[model samples]
Target: MRTEAIEAWTQLYAAVGLLAVICASCAALKTIVELRGGTVAFPHATWTQKFLWFPRLWLRFQLAYMSGFPCIMGIALLYAHYIGFAAFNPS
Candidate 1:
């Protein structure tokens, strides 16, 4: 019961971390396109335009690059470790 719950939670965390990594990749590609003077269309506007109009978007990008993906990956790793330990020492 508890082991099952832990396994489920670990899977959930891994899925979320994967999503974060994908998002980070997209953001990195957008940054590269913008740097090369190429355009990337977002929902409403181009990524370049968004960065210019919303300075916070730039900060968010930097934050994601610096910590967001790593933090999510860390959480996923922690959950996986817990699951492994629980499996080995069933108590």
Candidate 2:
């Protein structure tokens, strides 16, 4: 039982960590691109920008992604805790 829970918790945290890394790196990349005079993907985005806009939303998509990022990740953490992963338990 303990081993299984540990494995599950490990997997859950791994996924969450990967998601965080990807999000941050993508945001940084988009910022760098913009700093280099490239167009930001928002408001008047191109067709391609529409599909790859999530990370760029850090500074481009405005309030939605900015607020949604923490909200979404928090929900994921709550879900992990609700699943009986003791490692994820907040209290």
Best by lDDT: 1
* Residue pairs in collision within model 2: none
- TM-score for candidate 2: 0.46
Candidate 1 overall lDDT versus native = 0.64
Candidate 2 C-alpha lDDT tens digits along 1-91 = 4666677677777767777666666666656677567564264367787765665554463433354488558866776776665654433
What candidate 2 gets wrong by more than 4 Å, as runs, is 38-68, 71-91
Name model 1 segments beyond 4 Å from true: 38-91
By TM-score, the best candidate is 2
Q: Per-candidate TM vs. native?
A: 0.44, 0.46
lDDT of each: 0.64, 0.62
